[model samples]
Target: MNTGVVTGGWSYVWAAYSLTAGALFLYGVSLFVRVRRIVQ
Candidate 1:
């Protein structure tokens, strides 16, 4: 008998989490640079 659709969820979750964290990190760095430039 075939099981319900719950396989391969861990990889997908990890991918999504990593991408989101990376995007947020880059965004924060961009904001910091802009603020520093403005302060100068």
Candidate 2:
């Protein structure tokens, strides 16, 4: 009984989301530092 159903993909989904969020956070921090440096 092999129905076409996808399963057990939550780990991959969470990993992708975590990586994307981490990248965005790092980018935001970098931008903030650069702006502060320019303002000084």
Candidate 3:
């Protein structure tokens, strides 16, 4: 009776997505700051 279905893995998926988004956001902010500094 085993059909090989995964269940209850949403939390891990969300955690990984959140981490990736946060890292990208921080990287964008850092680049913005660097550009501003270079412009000044």
Q: Determine which window of 10 residues in candidate 3 has minimal summed lDDT.
A: 1-10
CA lDDT, every model vs. true structure = 0.94, 0.97, 0.98
TM-score result, candidate 3: 0.79
lDDT sort, best first: 3, 2, 1
* lDDT (Cα, 0-100) at 31 in candidate 1: 100
Cα RMSD of all models vs. native, in order, equals 3.5, 3.3, 2.9
Model 3's alpha-carbon lDDT is 0.98
Worst lDDT 10-window in candidate 2? 1-10
Q: Any residue pairs clashing in model 2, and if so which? A: none
Error of 3 at 1 (Å): 16
Model 1: per-residue Cα lDDT over 1-40, one tens digit each? 7687667688899999999999999999999999999999
Candidate 3 per-residue lDDT over residues 1-40, each given as its tens digit: 7799888999999999999999999999999999999999
The deviation in Å at residue 39 for candidate 3 is: 0.9
How many backbone overlaps does candidate 1 show?
A: 0
